[model samples]
Structures are given as C-alpha cells and as structure tokens.
Target: MEPRWLSQDEQESWLPFAAMLIKLPAALDAQLQRDADITHFEYLVLARLSMIRDRTLRMSELASVVSASLSRLSHVVKRLEQRGWVRRAPCPENGRFTNAILTEAGWEKVVATAPGHVEEVRRLVVDALSESELRQLREISSRVLQRIDPDAGTW
Candidate 1:
C-alpha cells in the first residue's frame, strides 16, 4: 500500500516539529559538552542513575530507561568508568547481571551541572510555552509516544 502524503497544514506543523527534534538534541548536547564535559546521553545515563535507589541500576534496566542499546550503554559506561564516575559490579542477587553504580564524584558532578541544564531546558523549551500550552503539549507527546512504543508504558 502506498503511504498517504501529509496535507499542507500537516506539513507546515511538522516542519517546525521535525526541525526541533533534530536541533534541540544537538543544542542540548553542545551545551552539556561545553559545561559538563559530557555528552547529553552520558548526562542522561548519569541522571537516571542519580534517580534510582542506592544510585545503582542493572545494565539492561539502565539501557531501557535511557533508550540506549546495550552496546552503546556499555561503551558509555566504560567511559564513565575511566573517569571514576561510575563502577560496575556483579548484581548481588543475580551474578549473571551487572549493575552500574554512580560514584560520589558522579553524583557531585551531576548535582553541579543540573542547575545549568535546567536553566538551558527552561530557556529552550519550558519558558516558551504557556501553562495551558505546556499541558496540552505533554498530553499530545504522551499520546504520540504511546502510539510509537506500546511497551513504553513499563517505564
């Protein structure tokens, strides 16, 4: 079956959204690299670890939460390990699995970087939207995400 082309209105709306999807991550990555000496994905991985109990999470779980492939996560984890920001140890309950544990230095680094990251996020996104528009955008985004990944609800 042939795919239906977008209508003019759809194209107009999608253009900016598509541009945002491409540009926003790049901008965030650039800011993080400059300010934190880490890529945005690394920040995300660390941030996710920060949020977990004991500042530790299984590799697979971390990969899922960060939307990263295991191999990609492994490489990033290795980098973090080299920096003494993260450590890997055999899971206590399951020896076959490994857990990523955030070090004190990692926690401190993320804590220091968070305010700047939050400021950047606000500057780039939140501050531009009205309260009602932000709510509406959240709802729309949730629906779109659900449609894109049915299993995403587990997160």
Candidate 2:
C-alpha cells in the first residue's frame, strides 16, 4: 500500500501547526514554572478541581478531565498532597472509588496562581488573535480534536 503524502498547501499549513503543538506546551510550562513553581499540567489539575462543586472529583473522572492517565494524575496528585493542596478519600457514594479533594490551601493556591497563569496565557495565545480569529481558532481546534478523540464527549 502507498502512503498519502500531504500536498504542498497541506504541508505548509501542517508545518506551523506541528511546530505549535511542539512548542506551546513547553512555553506554557516554562511560564508556569517561573511564576507559580508548578507545571502547567499541575495548574490545570488544581484549577479543574477547584471549579467543580465540593472541589472534588473521582480519580478516574479527574484523569479524564485532565486528559491524562490515572497513574500520571496520581503522581501529580501525590505531589499536590505533599504540598497540602489536595487530599484523597474514599468516595462517599462508592466504597471502592476514590475522590481527589482540594483543600483550603489548594483553593488559595489556585486563586493565587490563576492571575499570572491567565496573563501568560493571554500573552502567549489569546491576545495574539482578533475576536473573530479566536472564534475560528476554537472551531478549528474543536474539529481537529474531534478527529483525534472522537469518543471524548466532555471536550
């Protein structure tokens, strides 16, 4: 079988898109490291946890929300727990399930860290686009994400 190589137009568009995929995470992580002493992924986990009611989520649901593996999130959560930001407990509704609960300190951490993180995000990505462009970017990214993980309903 033969491969379907990209056309020149496709290649041109893909080149920059691929570069963004490579660089964006690093850029965000660097900003987070300098300002918050945490990686962007950690910020995401904490921020997501803070948003939900009760500031808690099932371990599996948290993993899915962050688009990470359970093991990976567990490691991050462990670090957070060590920092007094999060605690884990058996789910009230299901004895076999566990929940990650954000502590008071965790809420404070999120509140403290959010502004700088948001500023960096705006500086790096959001402010670079016009209003219309922002909408288009969301639509386009959603399309690509649909293709990448078609069964992901939450995204």
Candidate 3:
C-alpha cells in the first residue's frame, strides 16, 4: 500500500514542532547546567522527589514518574548519591524493591535551583504565550502525548 504522508499544511506544522522537540530540552538543559550545575534530567528527578510524600519513591515508580528507564534512572541516581543529594536503599515495606529518597541537601538544591529554572521557563515559554494560546498549547500537547503513549498522562 502507498504510505500516507503529511500534506503541505501538515508538513509546515510538523516542522516547527519537530524542531521544538530537539531545541527545548537543549535550551533547558543548558540553563540548568549553567546556573545550577545540574542537568535538566537531574533537576527533574530531584523535583519529582521533592513533591512526593517523605520525599521517597520506589525506584521503578520514580523511573515511571520521570519517564525514564530503570537503568538510566539508576545511573543518574548514582551520580546524585555521590553528591549526597540522593540515597538508595531497600524499601522497608518491601525489601525486594529499592527506594530513592531525596536527602536534605537534595531538597535544598531543588529549592535553590527552582527560581532560576522557573525564570528561564517563563522567559522561554510561559511569558511568550497569551492566555488563550497557553491553553491551546496544553490541549495540543495532550493530544499528541495521548497519541504517543495512550497510558502515559500529560506531564
């Protein structure tokens, strides 16, 4: 069968979106690295932990929350551990699973880093969009994410 293809209009729309997928992360990561000495993914792991109860999450659950593989998360967690930002141990409730717990230092780092990150995000995205456009952007992203992974909800 002949393949379905994006028409001219669809191609025009897709081009910018595809470029954004690459550029946005790089820009965010660059800001985090410069200001916080952390990569964007590291910030995400810490931020996610900061929001949870006890600042603790099972390793697998943390991976899911961060949209990372367990192996990749483990490596990042290892780096965090070395910086005294995070620690891993057997889950008290279930020794078969490990838990990632944010340390006091990790919490402090998140608190300190968040302002600069938020400012950068606001400068780059939030402040650029009108209220209606912001809502439309959210709706459009949700639809695309649903198509990409039906089980994974929007971030």
- The numbered model that scores best in lDDT is 3
Error of 1 at 7 (Å): 1.3
lDDT of 3 by residue, 9-121 (tens): 99999999899999999999999999999999999999999999999999999999899999999999999999999999998788899999999999999999999999999
Measured on C-alpha atoms, candidate 2 has an lDDT of 0.94
Reference-based TM-score of each model: 0.95, 0.95, 0.94
After the best TM-score superposition of candidate 1, give how far the Cα of residue 75 lies from its true spot, in angstroms. Answer: 0.7
The TM-score of candidate 1 is 0.95
lDDT, candidate 2, 44-76, per-residue tens: 999999999999999999999899999999999
Number of clashes recorded per candidate: 0, 0, 0
Ranking by lDDT: 3, 1, 2
lDDT of each: 0.94, 0.94, 0.96
The TM-score obtained by model 3 is 0.94
Give residue 123's error in model 3 in angstroms: 0.7
For model 1, residues 1-155, the per-residue Cα lDDT tens digits are 99999999999999999999999999999999999899999999999999989999999999998999999999999999999989999998989899999999999989998899999999999999999999999999999999999888774
Q: Native-vs-model 1 lDDT?
A: 0.94
* Model 3: pairs clashing at backbone N, Cα or C within 3 Å: none
